[model samples]
Target: MRALVFPAILVLVMAVIGHVLTLHLVPSVIMGTAMNRLAAQGAALHSFRLAPRTTPQTQLVVRPSPDLAYSICAYHLRGPQPLRIRAAAYDDYGSISFFDARTNNFATIRIEETAPDSSGPDILLRGPAGGEPDGLFDGHDLKSPTPRGLILIRRLAPTQQAYDRVKAIASADVCALSSSAGTISE
Candidate 1:
């Protein structure tokens, strides 16, 4: 039994090292692959791409909800301007989520939380190096840990008719530079 002690310790050390490496590196690897795939699929930087209804053959995400429509944007915050994201408000359930390079979801907004009288939830996203814009802007502000990331918007639409309606409503969703972007040069 004593002769097996060294082998056992070696195996345990290797397993622990592998676990630590996977935990630290896997998220970024997955996120990077996703970003590249989205870019290759015509998802331009700073623009919204409305994904088609989820079918087994058309699913891009890990496990997309069959009852929701999706819109995506692969954002690159390297420029001086802050990005503006606006999701059109709807009576049905909807949400917008922001993910950084490490696949960390840093922010999310629900449709019900938006102002009913306005177009929808408008948001300004800045990089870690960016500062708050001057004057007043009519939206929430967020600071991202990384300059490169993704934005995903999901709207509940279980059937064909519901999907069509959700798509139509989501057409108004905007992912672009803020109108006041010039003011925030950093």
Candidate 2:
């Protein structure tokens, strides 16, 4: 009985350790691979760029939907600066999602969430440590808990013709660092 008790306790301890390690490792592995792939594609910091078409060859992100056009902007709040994202209002469905380094989504803005009277799409994002923004131009303000993260822009395009149109609209979208001189440009 004594021997069995000791072995059972050891097994339980090992199981707990394994579980904790897995929880910590999985997100790191996934985020690391994504960051590496984005780097290889020449995705600059604080800039938005179109993601490659979902093909059997592309492995940066899993389960890519062929019916959608995806774009990404990688950001690092080194100086705790704000990021400005702008997209003209369109008739089709679209969204912008913010994810942290650990792959946790902190904030998301979608076309449906915008007011019907809203003129256009714009967002002001700051790091968790940054201050609030003022004088936003009908923009939504969001805070990210992490200093480094990704901004993903997804637009629906069910058919080739729709895809072309959405692609053109997405091409005009901009993500860039806000200037410190009280001016914003994309």
Candidate 3:
């Protein structure tokens, strides 16, 4: 009986220490991996520009999902929102990673409506990061300045309120993004 108790106590003590260490250690290990990748990709690349196409701006413009990161070759706004892309992209930012938005290991873009009586993130963009962007524009290979980190036009998604409020800067133009295939020039 004494021998049994000693083994049991040792097991219990070991379990407690393991559990406590894992609580913080496991998370740091997992989160650290992702952070390392983002860093390896390099802090938001800051050397690209969008060239306006002569098209009449009749296409529905969309930005790519940040998780589906890729080289943003070009992005344009024909509507009145004064659309601007605050982004940091890599040289190979044109890679795409589209997956199921509901249940997938990868990131996704979800939609939600804001309440009239409250201020909050109305439309939810369910990625590794969550956001309530008013509008969201997405395309695999878009032409833009910053070519990475889920380039958001800060609420470019289509909805009743967004359509009405930001229609001026809104356009049906679908912006395209992709890798340049050579050394990026300044």
Candidate 4:
């Protein structure tokens, strides 16, 4: 009985170790691979690119809905300047979500939550190392836990016409660095 107990304990310890390593390492590996793929597809760091409408043949993400338009940005926030993100509010449904290096969603802004009279919401993204931004800015201030991450913007567009319209609006979306003068500049 004593011998059996020791072996069971050993196996349990090994299982626990494996579980911990998988939990810590898998997310980083997956996220890194995704970032690399996006970079290869001409996704510039700190700049927004309107993704082509999701088709089964070109779908990089899992189970992307055909009824939505997507714009993606792979952001690196290690610089001294903080990133500024702005998206045109859709009439119906739209949202921007920020994900950290580990694929953890740190923030999301939905168009429905914007003020009725506002055109859209302005977001300021800063890394953990970045201090409070200089000057007064009317926007949502978001702090990223990591210096590297991705931003995804989705808008509902059921038809080709709607997709084109969403694309036009998304083209005006800003994912750039904030200048010392407190203005966003690509």
Q: Quick one: best TM-score, which candidate?
A: 4
RMSD of 4: 2.4
- Per residue, candidate 4 scores C-alpha lDDT tens digits across 1-186 of 888998999999999999999999999888999889988998898898888888888787777899988899888888668898888778878999999998899999996678767768888899887778766786788999999999999999889899989877777788898874268776
TM for candidate 4 is 0.87
Q: Is candidate 2 or candidate 4 better by TM-score?
A: 4
**Candidate 4: 10-residue stretch with minimal lDDT:** 177-186
Give the candidates in order of TM-score, highest first: 4, 1, 2, 3
| TM-score per candidate, chains pooled | 0.85, 0.82, 0.28, 0.87
On the 0 to 100 scale, the lDDT of residue 45 in model 2 is 79
lDDT string for model 3 (111-145, tens) is: 11223332222111122222222334332122212
User: lDDT per residue, candidate 1, 64-101, as tens digits?
Assistant: 88898999988888755688888888888889999999
lDDT of 3 at 134: 30
Which residue pairs clash within candidate 1?
Answer: none
Whole-model alpha-carbon lDDT for candidate 3: 0.29
Off by over 4 Å in 3: 44-186
Error of 4 at 67 (Å): 1.2
Candidate 1: minimum summed lDDT over ten consecutive residues — where?
A: 177-186
lDDT of 1 at 26: 92
Worst 10 residues of 2 by lDDT: 111-120
